[model samples]
Target: MIVFNEDGCIKCGACQGTCPTSTITVTPTYIQHCDMCGQDPKCAEVCPEGALKVEMFTVDENALDQPRLTFNSSLCTSCGKCEEVCPQETCVVVGKPNMEVEGFCVMCKKCVEICPVQVIGIPGIVEPKDCAIDLEGKGATYIVNCVGCGTCVEPCPVDAITLDKVGGTISIDENVCIKCGVCSQTCPWNAVFISEKYPVKREKDIIDFAFDSTSCIGCNTCVEACPGNFIKTIGSNLTIEVPDICAACGLCVKVCPTDSLDLVVKWGEAHPADAEGLGYDAEKCEFIGACANKCPTEAIRVVTKTGMACPSLVQTDEDPSFVNCIRCGACAAVCPEGALTVGSIEKMIDGKLVMRDRIEFNPSKCTKCGDCETACPYNMIHLTDDEKLPVKGFCTLCGQCIEACPEHALYDK
Candidate 1:
């Protein structure tokens, strides 16, 4: 049967939803266990944390077999109180306290009552011939820093990867995993690094990268602009090692003060590499319904957002102009991952509200202190020779200039 480590569970309902047998159930604050699915249990597969696990057990014939004691590590401080009170010295080891020692624990309740933090817990005693749970036999384990992308779940040949409904990360059932290394190679974040033990290796992509240190002033602009966090500045020297996870977004290239960094995308020449009007990146999108929820025209549709199982999509390119889209930047503004980039801005053009830049210019509050020009990471905002604010270059709508303006001149359109 599948049981939960109550302290570790976040009550996300990931396991309950994935259970094929519909045995698992979850409430706002409580979670109920389920009978194991016999085959690879789906409940264990989707658990983001390794709080839930499967254990094989047989009914103990002896009536005196004591109930297993569960430990709460969150409330434990290693006070050694349980160790001092527990009659069996083998039961309560200093750091690794094992409350359930077969034939050792006499159920004196001395450790339970003396625990200052109440970490030692004893559940109801099981009747004779009941399931004797062996808690130490939990078969699942999770790697550190799992991004909960659910990418590993699909590649597992044995279906050992867990799916996290909470959009956190995934856990792997070590017992079910064949160590084939498919999940390790498929993971974009390298959350599963067990591939090193096997022959599986990720193919290297052809990339053309260039950085001129002579022109670079070490202003730390590229580090701040890069969304992938591929660039790092140490004193005056910049370190760029983005072969594995670089999206090639060119935010670093645009924010470079001296035009020192240059990157060429070998796959596609386009900067965004998407359709003109409403650009969307499926790889970066988490299907959180932020764009579809905020889209005024209802142009974008996500299948997962509507509780559909398949055919997850945004919008088609049939209407590249996005005629229904008001270009209000509502979708782009609300998108958490910046997946949806609107091409047109909502502004008056020939008495028509065409898609235009979302940025607004207020000349009344303009002090022209040149702070906006300095604050613009993309170097888009600048003061003309006559000291007039001239926004000539491409604006990413990053809102850096708005924060930099002391007079509160700039505001979102």
Candidate 2:
């Protein structure tokens, strides 16, 4: 059974939610208690406020030791409901008893509100009564109907109810089982049950990643963001190698501003690939194929029909940082031929080497709209079809394919 400090209660009702039994009741001012159901209290184990306490008896005589609930007067708020519903006459100071009393309390403390200063304390049973285990199967021993009021921490036998913090989940120590069944009987949620049917089991899942030679960009972003110290970049291309310690939290995917890093699960599932779709343009795209080079998973690759290198339509020494690339598929959207393809790296990886079917560019579709280039954060896209397009040239070399190409054959020289 759990006890409460009426004055200390904020009336949040968190204890009622955790109790395995429906033994706890809250009044406008204070909480009421039931003694018979509280022989072994589970309510005290779930309070997060530390407003409750557990009472234990000492064997030594002449010790002046009495197991009583103590409430801090400094904390009490003068809630009187604790006295209104107490089972014992001494437990409550309400006007009159609405129900008849069966017997005198044996100082069992079943009605004690450990919230010392404000609420009353009625003594009842101290030792738990031994009862036969009628249920053969392992089922919930405690079925508490929780009111979500967290007042039961006071009388817990094991000092289990810790209400000072968030309510933690319940745990049972099988090794300490005297099978007293106190916890099961006192729980309000009916969340606790005992079973002799099957053995207990536990399991956990782990994942790891490894970047191929051409996959990583050596950005070190994955290494810095990985919580498990699993990834390390080797060179400027962001080339990476994942160690055995990787837990695969996918933080690398979130931190990669270039959208280069990716996570591959054991079942062939890829991270960032499953992310939401973004818009892109296919026409007017210069096949410079920067997106493929920047991809960390090697999921994107450029395929050329001829062995000759495609001439660079534009070049600049200024490094364009991906930090400014707003991912507006402008370069791909204005292409004339069906040569440019733009999408998430994962979708690009799923395509065939030729990608002819996936590539889309229609000059007829062009409305001379400059919306695509205006959306470029790096200012890499030019509004005109001219090959020697003037640019701000802040390219980080994190190639996002140019969308202004009309030849359908432009490449990095």
Top candidate by lDDT: 1
lDDT of 2: 0.34
Instruction: Let me know the TM-score candidate 1 reaches against the reference structure.
Output: 0.19
Regions of candidate 2 where Cα sits further than 4 Å from its true position: 1-359, 378-380, 386-413
Worst 10 residues of 1 by lDDT: 267-276
Candidate 2 lDDT over 1-413, as tens digits, reads 33454533322233332232334544334555444335432222322332223465542353433442323333333344333444432233222333211111233432332221223333232322222233332222222222222223322344444333223344444333222233333332223333211111111123434444555456686666553344656665547765532233345665665666556533221111112232233343344445434432222333322322222323444332221223223334333331222433322433432211121233444554554345332343434453333222112223344333334432321
The estimated TM-scores of all candidates read 0.19, 0.17
Clashing pairs for model 1 are 45-162, 46-163, 148-168, 148-169, 344-355, 344-356, 345-355, 345-356, 345-357, 346-356
Model 1: how far residue 213 lies from native, Å: 1.6
How would you encode candidate 1's per-residue C-alpha lDDT over 1-413 as one tens digit per residue? 22344433223233443333233454433544322332243333433333223343332344333332224444455444433433323223334443221112223443333221232333333211221223221211225455454645765767878865524557776546544446654553434544122112233232665788777776777776553345656663544433322433454665576888877643312111111233334444444444434332233344443354212244433322111122333222222333333343464435766553333443434555554334332333445443233322223444443343334433344
RMSD of 2: 28.4
**Candidate 1 CA-lDDT value:** 0.40
